[model samples]
Target: MLPFVLSAALLEVVPSGKVPSSIPTASSTATIPTVMITRGQEQTVTPDWSRLSFANLPAITQSGSLNGQKWSAGQPVEKLLTLGDFQDSFKLQDLNLYAIAVATQMPIKLVKLSQFKLLAGQTLADLALAVPELEQLPVSTVKPLSDLLKSAKPSYRLTEKTLPQLLEQDPTLGALSFQNFDLTGYTLDKLPGLIHAPLQAFRHWQEAKLTDIPGLREMPWQQFPNPPSDSSMSGVIQLPTTMSYRLGKDSTSISGSSALGYQIPCAGCTSITFSDPPALQKKRWISGLAQWVQGGISDVAQSTTHSEPTGRNVFGKAFKVVVTEVSPKQAQTALYFRFCQFQQQISCSPYAIGPVPFLSYRNGELMPVGNLEIGTDRSITPQMLPSVKQILPTIPTEIPSTVNHWSELLSQILEQIKALLHPPATPTA
Candidate 1:
């Protein structure tokens, strides 16, 4: 939130002849009026060095009083000026007018102008003369920008009527932030003269509801001090010629030669295009134990009578080798491969395989069919090993029907994982 700092105090002086004869006179000390004139709510004034030490200390406190009694003691007049006339009479020398005017002009530096309260029907011209540096003027009625441009302030924000006027005076004034003003009814023939000014940043211009910006045929390339390295300026230059002609060739910085060759350059000088990975890579990987249960590949059928197989090695290979019976540890590896392939096909291949669990198989004792011994002289490739560390939960001695359910769940999990790894693309009808 913007801080609002109050400016100097205001005093309403009345002629002494208006004081009633019935009023009691001061004896040893002087008496001061306690009444004050207020436009809206009465505001409290904090004392500063100058105001605190003033001779009329009593009058200072009464100046901010809400009641009009302060002026009652002064001479009566035939008529009193309205608020507009009073504001019009404002002189630079008057401390009240001077302070408020300065406050209105440099609002960021000095916030609330407590002395001057704008009444209805006031225009920007009225405020501009008093506060020349003011970038904004909150007025009740919309007025012409020509009145505002009579002074050289960079910006002004008001209703719809004033926007065209503002643009007419200075189109290149960049960085406009406005709200609730409708431009739909107006026929915008062209953009303003100030469009050539380097517009570095704009806050909410894209969100605005402007139907036509006839001035913006070509892109504002020079506006950004440093554009993105891969940005293409061609589309910006090829905008409708109707919009271009209105902007005027002189008003836009882009030249015909530059617009002709605005294509972005890449490593191979080829236009970049993106595609999705093959669907076959989406299939799940089975662990050695799961593979045995699902009958994906038979351990007994593929194994040869070699050395003795024993202990944990016997059970480890029994569960893990296929897509359906895969363990969580092996499932993670398959998912990672599928994800990488889907995003960057060149980096991943269809030949990719998950880790093979090491287990022991013996002939005599309940011969753990489909299980291989850990110490067996079997060759493995670096590419076959999981890229990441395998985090295995306590291996279940008994396989359950729930394993199939888990496999189906893995498909959904892989889909979510893939979405995070890739950018959103247009959905096919």
Candidate 2:
């Protein structure tokens, strides 16, 4: 399967080698072949074809068919830019790797590519993936990232600006398209700009480090693709079918009252009636692009609240997301965040929380699926204990019929007290 990834870089030098007579040398009908030298080999190679080597090739030509373009179109040939053009090298990820083995002409060897001078601030390491010859260049001649300047360790690196600039230099260079080549140059945080990146047939993003960057979901792009409907890619669109949230701990827990239906209303969703014929379309669009998303966490939403352990707590439910993949599209991943629960949580435990945003392209246009919940784990429900009333220690409250009719007794006692206080009153009493 092809992935939509492309890249660009400097042309490599061809090593010296003896020419195989069967190989065609050029585009014109010349009798004598030309001499070309490669970089790694020790001998020179001579070929019998004209200087117009790949000019007559067709779209699916045996010469080389990359990203649907034949050698006759001259893109691959142009992408194999002259070594003198190295100061502004870009990537060529648009080529269909399976069909990019072009038989070269003589006097024009891959080795000649390495003789070009690099720009002042260019990172030579950035081109190593597309052109492995950079690894052989001496540190003095090929200045890489600042890290290479150190006397201790001399590992090279490309900056966030590296890829974008390379693509800017050559529009013909594919941005991230190497299917078989290794892209050790790019890091998780240093993704190439999407606007200049080329569309690919099959792309595997799992290899890139994408976990660290923030605001990844909202990156800008000139064009993006819609998710493909290929069943094999369905896993890429994983979303929660039902979402459950546990707000407060223990006695102070809050649970859905069932009657209200378990869901937090999505903002601006009041106008939507998801009835059978549905008042709203399942997808949303802005500009000419369709909206597709992978995440929508509470933090990215309107707001959220705190929770305590024992008092009445706010409990609510949110709807799960369902994402359908798009096709021929290059998607951009914008980051939200997540508290991983089941398998792996981003921040917290027991429940996975999040809306990890990712843009999908269909036919190279962004899919407008609206805010999607990209990350969702198991539904977590709080454990609660039954409530009980306290009882006083066993003191008997039973009384017989003769128990206390103190009305008469109280009157007698009052009279006796009065007589004692006053002697005349006592006599009358």
Candidate 3:
């Protein structure tokens, strides 16, 4: 049933577009180059069937033009069928070139499948059957394989139902990709038969809300190219206790093991009990205008005051003072001070002078308590110092001043503390 005539004599077809006298032939050991069959203007009527001899052929390539294509091969001659009208169609009974290409591990290029008028319900089934050995197929005509296997290439995307079909047809798919699909509400129960599939690698498995897969008792984790980290899978809640799999991040967790059960004991959680006391709350108090101003003046007086040691050896005690004032303008100030009992010891004090309608502290000099350059030389003497009124002139009376003024004041306070703790080195002689 060969469509073209064949003879024992060799035939030669010239590149000048003329049929030659000799036909090309090759030995079984010789490697065969890829063959391309293109539909020309001369061939208009679609061919119903075709055949291929795979005995000496290593590979073949097929392409469909405006007409038709078909092929078949085997001892009884296994036949392949491609049925498409003007476009492309796949038929189980029709032997087409595309079928031959696939069955022979060759390549086939079809101009258009949709252009051909295909019979109802036959196109998908025929294509599926014809390309049984096809490892890669474009998702243009059908849904991607990712939707079928929960694990596919990282970039696989197909309709929800397509995955089941793919899995049913071929369970040996190795890699799967589902980069950005939201599997929020989908559960493992929706897909019952995937446990037997040969899917080993999965990306974005955590994005799928799969609580448990009872059918999947073990995983072929060794086949995973890049397994997921433990943290990636740790967020998955309520996994089956009997299931066990190694995570990509090098941490292994056994489901039914005592270390990881219904309620895992969190270490270092002694202070993390539910019955712990609530954190302490902070308190704030309000003061009248008179009290506020009075407190401020008292603070100024105490800061300017000084004390001397009593002759009876009762250490000199600096006067303690506090200022809490809220002005008519809503400005406020809170200040506190405490004096040391020892003559040589410095006073420890704190002051919060703000909400000032305008006034801010400035620099001033302190008179030493004693003339001797001993341990108490740095101590200020209240007797020799002027009153708070004298120091007020040196302080700023401006309101809403620059923030730098506050910073400078805080810096001065810090410097004073530092000097008290660690006195400046004596000037090098």
Query: Counting only residues 3 or more apart in sequence or on different chains, how many pairs clash (N, Cα, C under 3 Å) in candidate 2?
Result: 80
The C-alpha stretches of model 1 lying farther than 4 A from their native spots are 1-206, 209-212, 220-224, 228-429
lDDT by residue (198-302, candidate 1, tens digit) is 211121222211111121111121211221111111221111111100100111111100101111111111011111112111111112111111011112112
How many clashes (backbone N, Cα, C below 3 Å) per candidate?
26, 80, 40
Q: How close is candidate 1 to the true structure, as a TM-score?
A: 0.17
TM-score of each: 0.17, 0.19, 0.13
Error of 1 at 41 (Å): 80
The list of candidate 3 runs beyond 4 A from truth reads 1-94, 99-110, 123-126, 134-429
lDDT of 2 by residue, 1-429 (tens): 111111121111111110111211122213222344332222222221233222321111112211122232212222322211111111122421111222121122221212111211123333434343333444343332323333223343333334334345544332322232232443322221211222221132111112111111122111112111222112232121111111111111111111111121211110111111121223221110111111212221112121100100011111112121212222222111112111132112111111112222223121222222221222222211111110001111231235263344334334433222111000000
Sequence-dependent TM-score of model 2: 0.19
Q: What is the C-alpha local distance difference test score of candidate 2?
A: 0.21
Ranked candidates (TM-score, high to low): 2, 1, 3
Q: For model 3, what is the error of residue 248's alpha carbon versus the real structure, in angstroms, after optimal superposition?
A: 95
Root mean square deviation (Cα) for candidate 1: 38.0
